[model samples]
Target: MAMSPEQPSAPRRSRIALWLVLLLLLALGGYAGWHQWRAREQAVVNSTQQQVDALSERLNAMRTEQRAQARRLQQADSLNRVLRDELDGITQRAALLETSVERLADPDRHGAQALRLDETEMLLTIGSQRLQIAGDLDGARRAYALAAGVLDGIDDPAYLSLRQTLLQERTALDALGADPRVRAIAQLDAYTQTVTAPAGREERARDERAPWWQRAFGNLLQVQPTDRAVAVQAADRAAALAGLQLEISLARAAAERRDTAGYRDALRRADTWLQRLAPDSAARTQQRAQLQALAALPLSLSVPTLGSTLQQLRQLRAR
Candidate 1:
C-alpha cells in the first residue's frame, strides 16, 4: 500500500481537475440566470416608462382644454358687461326724453293765457262730444257758453279770431230750433188719445141701423173702407192696441237716442198697427198724415261749423 509517492500525486491531480470542472459549470449557470433577470427587469422598466409618458400627455391635453374654456368664459363675461352698459345708457336716454317732453307740456310756463286756452279747448271738446254722441242739446249749449267765457278772458290778439269762430258755431247751434223729439212726443200723445177714445152716440146709431146681413155678420167680420176685413173679438182688439202702444214706445225710445232711421222705422210700424186699431175714415187719414209728419222730423242738427273753434285753437297752439 506504500508503494510509491508518484502514484498518490497522480490521483490527487485527477481529483483537483474534477473539482475545477464543477466550479466552471457553476459559474456559467450563474452568469446565464443573471443575464435573464437583467433582461426581464429592463422590459418592466420600459413598460412602466411608456405608461408614465401616456399619463403626462393626457395631463397636458387637459391643461390646454381648461385654459381654452377659461378664455371663452372671460369673453362671454366681457360681452355681458358690454350689453349691460348699453342697456343702462338706453334707459338713461329714455328717461331724459320723457322728462324733456313733460317740461314742454307743463302749463305753468305759459301763465294765465295758457290756462285760459287749455280750459277753452277742454270745454269745446266736451260740447262736441255731448252734441254728437249723447244728443244732449242743452248740455252742449252750456259747454259752449262756458268755453266762450273762458276764451274771453284771454287778451291775446292772436286768439281774437278764435272767439269769432266760436261765436259763429254757437249761433249755428241756436238756429237748430226746438227739439223734434218734444214735438213728436206731443203728437203721439194726441194720436193715442184720439184712437183709444170710445166712439160717439152717432156711430152706435149707425151700427144699429146697419143692414140685416151686415148686422148678422158684424160679430164675425168688419170690412174697412180699404177692403180689409177686421176681427171683431174684444181680445183681438186689445192685442192690436197693445201692439200699437209698444210700437209707439219704441219710436219714443229711438227719438231719445237721436236714432233717426230707427225712429222713422218704429213710426212706420206704429202706423201699421194704427190701421188695425182704427177703421179707415177721414180721421184715420188725418192721423196717418200727422204720423208721417212726425216720422219726417229731424232728430239731430247738422252744423258744418261745429268744431271750427277747436280747429283754430289747435292751429294757434301749434304755432
Candidate 2:
C-alpha cells in the first residue's frame, strides 16, 4: 500500500504527455481551418470581379449604341425639318400665285393687262396645239417668243411672278425639244427648198437656154414681137398623170433618203396635180391610191410632256 514517490511522478508525466499531444492536434486543425477560410474568401472576391467586368462591357456597348442612335435621330429630324420648311415655302408661293391670277382676271382689267393676257393665252394655245398635233418645235418656239414679247412689256412688280413662271415653262418646253429626232422633220423641210432638181433638169435647162439667145436677140438684131398671149396648150391628161406618178416615185425615194420635208412636199404636189388630172383617166385610180399611201406616212416627232408650270398657271388662272 505504501507507493513509492517515483510511481506517482510517472503518472504525472504521462498526463503531461497526453495533454501536449492534444494541444498539438488542436493547433494544426486551427491552421487548416484558417487557410480554407482564406481560400474561400479569395474565390468569392474573384467571382464578383468577373461579374463586374462583364457588366461593365455590356454597359459600354449599350452606351455606344445609344449614342449612335441619338445621332441618327438628330440627322433624320433635321432632314424632316428642312423638307417641311421647303413645303411650307412652296405652299405660300402657290397661294400667292393663285391670288395674283384671280386679281388679273377681274373686271376693270387694265388695257395693258388685257393685251398681255390675250397674247399670252393665244401663244399658249398656239404652242400647245403645235406640240400636240404636229410636234413642231419651231412653231412652239415662235409661240413662246410671242409670249415672251408680251411678258417683256410688263414693268409692274406685281407681274414679276407670272412672268417668271412663263419663263420657267418656256425653259421646260425648250428642254423637251432639245432632242435631234424632234427637229428632223422641220429641218428636212428647210432642206427641200434648197435641193437641186434631179438628173434630167440640167439637160432641160440647157435645151431651154439654147433658145434663150434667139429670144434675147432677134434676126439682124431686130426686136422680136413677144407673143404674150401664147396660150399653154392643154397638158396631155395621160402625160400629166404620168408626171404625177413620177412625183410620187420621187417622194418615195426622198422618204428612203430620210428627207421628210422633201417627201411631204413632193407627195402634196403630186396629190394636187392628181386632182387636176381628168377623173376618167385610167391612171386616176392608181394615182389616188398612191396619194392615200403618202397620206399614211408618219412624220410627227415624239409628243412631249406639257410643262407643270404652265399647267399650274392655268389652274391658278381658273381659280
Candidate 3:
C-alpha cells in the first residue's frame, strides 16, 4: 500500500512548473505597472514645461508694456518743459506791456514820449509774436492736413496775415542785406585795393562834388520842413491837452447833472489817459492826482455851486 519514489518525483516536478508560471506572470505585471508610471510622469513633466513657457511669455509682455509706459512719461515731461518755458516768456512780455501802459498816464512831455516809444515797441513785439505764432500754427495745420488728406482754406484772414508777415520779413531782410552802408562795409578791402591803385586818384577827386540837384536845392529838404514840423507838433500837443481837458469838463458836467453814464465815461477816459502816459514823467503824477481828486468828488453836487467852485479854482490856479 506505500507510494512509489517515481510518483513522489513527478509531483515535485509539477509543483516547480506551477511556481515558474506564477513568477513569469508576476514579472509581466510589474513591467506593465512601471511603464504606466513612467508615461504618467512624462505627461506631468510636459504640462509643467507648458506652464513655464506661458509664464515666460506673460513676463515678456509685461516688460514691453513697462518700457512703453516709461517712454510715454519721458515724452510728457519734455512737452511739459517746453510749455512751461513758452508760458514764462509770454508772462514776461505781458508784464512789460502792463508796465508800459502804467507809464502812459503821466502828463509830462518826457512821459508822453516814453509812453509813445513803449507803445511802439509793444506793437512791434505783438506783430513779431503774431508772425511766429502764425508760422508755427500753419506748420501744425499742414501736418494735420496731410494726415487727414485735406487742405485748409487759404482765404482765412489769419492765413493771409501770416503770408503778408512772412513776405514783409523777407523783404526787410533783403533790404538790410542790400543797404549801401552794409555793402560798403563788406567791401572795405576791395575799396582799399582800388584806392591804393595807381589809377584811383582822379576817380576819387571827381566823386567829391555835390550833385546838381543837391546844389540847386541848397539843403532845402535837409531843413526837415521845420515850419510844418512845428505846426504838427503844436497840433499834437493841443489835441492831447484838449482830450484830457474835455474829459475833466465832461466829468464835472456829469456831476452837476447826476448822470452816472457820463461820469463813468469820463472816468474811463481818464483811466485810458493814465494807461497811455509815461511811467517816469511829472505829468503822469499830476494826472494821477487829478484823477484821484475827481474820483473823490461828490456825484450829486448842485450845478450852479459846482460851476462856481470850478471857476474859482480855475481863477486861483491862473493867478
RMSD of each: 9.8, 18.3, 30.4
**lDDT of all predictions, in order shown?**
0.82, 0.64, 0.49
- Candidate 3 deviant stretches above 4 angstroms: 1-10, 106-112, 115-319
TM-score for every candidate vs. truth? Answer: 0.60, 0.34, 0.34
Query: On residues 1-319, what C-alpha lDDT tens digit does candidate 2 reach at each position?
Result: 7975655578888999999998999999999999999999999999999999999999999999999999999999999999999999999999998977767776756656756776777787788788666656778878877887876786756556767777776776676645344344344343333222321353345446756675455333634237422111233444555676677667656764556787778878776655654333455465456456544555544434454435654664565
Runs of candidate 2 with Cα error greater than 4 angstroms are: 1-8, 110-319
lDDT by residue for model 3 (1-319), tens:
9986755578898999999999999999999999999999999999999999999999999999999999999999999999999999999999998866665664532454453333433433443343244323233323322322211222323333333433444344333333232232234334223322322343234334757775566435434343332212224434544565567567656654556577667866855544332233574465556555445444331112112222332343234
User: Which stretch of 10 consecutive residues in model 2 shows the poorest summed lDDT?
Assistant: 191-200
In what order do the candidates fall by lDDT, top score first? 1, 2, 3
Clashes of each: 0, 0, 12
Q: Which of 1 and 2 is the better model by lDDT?
A: 1
164-197 per-residue lDDT for model 1 (tens digits): 9999999998987665667677776776666555
lDDT at 175, model 3: 39
Identify the candidate with maximal TM-score: 1
Show pairs that collide, candidate 2.
none
